[model samples]
Target chain A: MELFQEVILRTGFLALTWGQLVMWAVGFTLIYLAIRKGFEPLLLLPIGFGILLANIPLTPLMTPGSGLIWRFYHYGLEWEVIPPLIFLGLGAMTDFGPMIANPKTLLLGAAAQVGVYFTFFLALLLKFTVPQAAVIGIIGGADGPTTIYLASKLAPEMMGVCAVAAYSYMAMVPLIQPPVMKLLTTEAERKIVMKSLRPVSKLEKIFFPVVALFVICLIVPDAAPLMAMFMMGNLFRESGVVARLSNAAQNELMNIVTIFLGVSVGATMPAATVLQPKVIFVFILGCAAFMLATATGVLFAKFMNLFLKEKINPLIGAAGVSAVPMAARVVAKLGSEANRKNYLLMHAMGPNVAGVIGTAVAAGMFISVLAK
Target chain B: MVNLESPLSGKILEINMEVGQQVNEDDEVIIIEALKMENPVYCPATGVVKEIKVRIGDQVNEGDILAVIE
Candidate 1:
């Protein structure tokens, strides 16, 4: 009788708290957002599962070394190991041909990262300290894994909130980018069409990774882990000989790592830690950072237009966010809205890939200055 | 595994190889016009083209076999 009573008492069914329940609800909301709305299901689904597992009463999922999920969180996420692995997958999937086709798009990539620094100052103004501000500022980059990796390293306590903010904002790129893009460019600028991209030669395609490796590594050694892995993946793809390696990186290796990365990152959000005023600020600041990034890209493109004879389509500027295909599609959709015949997908891709490189460099910068 | 299949459901514009012709991987075995893209059905494996399934201007699906290599 006593054993039965003790078992019942110790069971999570008897110990549910309001806060935990609220967290469970938030987890479900994330799942719904991913499943029903189709907002980054590959990431959000695993993240939602992590949130659910972490909040279950009496579970040691996040207790470190005790629970299986907790072990995943500790060895993979907390130590900042999984993100770089995920970068390998991302690198393999990336094609730098578009960026190679139009080398000028590199400037838009650099311009987009200005928001990260600007937001870093803003977070500092909010009294989050310099390291916290750097993590917070990275939300503007709209690269979830990079933001999460940086936040986990610079300010471990802020990891839960900052990661959620970064990912949510990344998923919301379509919603957030349009308003900022519309605000920055004139109707004529939106309608302006540039000439078709010159067909990039196979030689230039091969040369790109070498130049990028040298420039990015020399300029930002901190970004080397992510950028180097990314460039290596791209090099393997472009090299035309390593079909086996590229295939593994793109399919088998990437798919395996993404599952682990998504779930472990989601597990960081414990109710006791995630539901705070600072978290709210993280979300707010993250939105501002994203908006600032989009606006910066558009405005920079406009600035460049003042000197160039051939008009550049400013809509491609918004592809400066590192969301890759999504950001590029948003640019194409917006361009179509302005003019039906405008085919901006290929054009936007140049900056879209460049933005991925840009964000990695920015993260490397933050890590160099603030990593403990 | 090598997948020697037509890219689209269109007639083969031309067949440059025969049943005994040796070809390398990614070598254009057939060309099919679909939409605006000149879809080239490349040899997925480096081997002798052992069979040709269709002549020029025959419709094909994405998985429809155009030829066999061995």
Candidate 2:
């Protein structure tokens, strides 16, 4: 009878705690949402499964050498291979034509970084260490891989919470952007019609990636790995001779990295690490950082209008965060809400792409200051 | 070298310039599309549109001549 009790006690069913059950439910919920609602399913689905695999009591999945999931985490994530590969795919898929057409948008992209730094200081006031705060604040930029890449390097312990915050905020771009956008501007400001974009030449389009690599890398060498891979991918797309490579990067490369990255990232969340007071602070600071980025973009656009004879629709300013299509779509939707005829999607894309490059450069700057 | 302008490799949705139109620099002459983004091919130099090589709904390749400027 005593031996039978010992065997029962050792079994996973008997060993499961209430907290573990709750965590399992939460993980399942995330998976459900990702599948049913399409909430970043590309990343979230794998992440949810990883979380489920990690949380089950008595599972050997993360047990040092014996765990399959744990082995994946160690190989792809700890070695810092997955994020850079994601950057390579992103580089291949991005179009620099809009940035080339209006090179001045680069300044708007640069100006948007003010929000990230400003939030960094705010995180410091809330008692986070400068490095930890810097990583947390960059979540506001709404660039998920960049956030994961930075947090993994600087404060690996904070990786799960920081990534969750970054992606959650990125997915919430439509929600978080508009209220701040409405508060900062009036009906007339939202309705402001901008001139159509000037035609960008194919030669100029081809020249942009090369020039960007030179100028941005020369200015911020620490960001070279991410920036160089991104620009090289863009070059592949623009070069007109690499259709097969470009398609592979956009589809195959993106899908593979996303699975590995999502799983490894989810596995890092070990409950104890993510349930801390500091983790809560990370989420709050992330919101402030994003709000500040959108505000800075809008304010800068308003300021630029003072210098130009022709005006730009300030709605495009909100797209200065690196959320890509989501941010650009938000800008267009807001414009249409204010005026029926406003079609600003293409116009907003110019600043949206600029925002991506700008945020990468800022990440390089942060690594230079904090990592070393 | 004779400068030739055409839509990038994609579907040409609309042709806005004719063979004899006096095309100026920056005028939208042809529309090519990919990834749901419609990109306009513009006149690179101020001149007469000597040829209209592609019609509506024709597919084009990068550097293919949609028009000639001289």
Cα lDDT listed for each candidate: 0.81, 0.80
Candidate 1, what DockQ?
0.03
Highest DockQ: which candidate?
Answer: 2
Question: Backbone clash tally for model 1?
Answer: 2
Off by over 4 Å in 2: A1-3, B1-70
Q: Evaluated with TM-score, which candidate comes out highest?
A: 2
Question: Compared with the true structure, what per-residue lDDT tens digits does model 2 show for residues A197-265?
Answer: 666777887788888889999999988878888888888888889989888888898898888888888
B-chain TM-score for every candidate: 0.86, 0.83
Summing lDDT over every window of 10 consecutive residues in candidate 1 chain A, give the lowest-scoring window. A336-345
Models 1 onward score TM values of 0.83, 0.83
Q: What digit string (tens of lDDT, one per residue) describes model 1 on residues A207-235? A: 78778888989988888878778778887
Clashing residue pairs found in predicted model 1? B9-B60, B11-B58
- Evaluating just chain A, the predictions reach TM-scores of 0.96, 0.95
Let me know the DockQ for model 2: 0.06
Cα deviation in Å at residue A23, candidate 2?
2.2
